[model samples]
Target: MNIRPMEYVNRERINRSKQLIFLEPEQKIQDISMRSGFEHPSYFCTVFKRLEGMTPEQFKKSHGFGI
Candidate 1:
């Protein structure tokens, strides 16, 4: 399957963010977004929602993180 480079990168970022959410429950969403290589937290949330069907914060809550 062919994927756009941006799409692949966003997917990877989202995956990394997911791991961070699970492993670093105390980390802030902004920090996680930066650690995941997103320059801006707003864009990170946008891409995350597009790929995961939820914002990072929502994902964290749904996954029982930062509760």
Candidate 2:
């Protein structure tokens, strides 16, 4: 299957978000979202939930981060 441009961008954002979650657990969600190239934290959370099935905070908690 061919991937669309937005799909690639979304995937990259998710990957970067995951990296930030692991590498910088202490970082704020807004900062992580910005670093992942999201213009707004709310939008980032929406996309992340759609892709990952859980919010970033939940993902972090699952990975043993205090959030």
Candidate 3:
């Protein structure tokens, strides 16, 4: 099976996403999107929510950040 470029996982992107999630729990998705190299905040939110099965706020709250 051939994997498409978009479907392939980039470890660096994953790491950046993790850092954005952990280091800036209180920051808005727009700011996180920029810092994480995502040009579109909405697209970022979509991708993030898809990968994690929830919004950023929900993820933070579930991880004990308390919203």
Who wins the lDDT comparison? 2
Q: Write the per-residue lDDT of candidate 3 for residues 5-65, one digit (tens) a residue.
A: 6644433454587687788777776787778777887877777777768876777788777
Please give the clash total of every predicted structure, in order.
0, 0, 0
**Alpha-carbon TM-score of each model against the true structure:** 0.92, 0.94, 0.70
Name the runs in model 1 displaced over 4 angstroms. none
Please give the ranking of all candidate structures by TM-score, highest first, separated by commas. Answer: 2, 1, 3
* RMSD from true fold, candidate 3: 2.6
Candidate 3 segments exceeding 4 Å error:
9-14
Task: Give Cα distance to truth, residue 5, candidate 2, Å.
Answer: 0.4
Q: Residue 40 CA error for candidate 2 (Å)?
A: 0.6
Ranked by lDDT, the better of candidates 1 and 2 is: 2
- For model 1, residues 1-67, the per-residue Cα lDDT tens digits are 4999988888998899999899998999999999999999999999999988988888988988764
In Å, residue 15's CA in model 2 sits off its true spot by 0.4
Residue pairs whose backbone atoms clash in candidate 2: none
Clashing pairs in 3: none
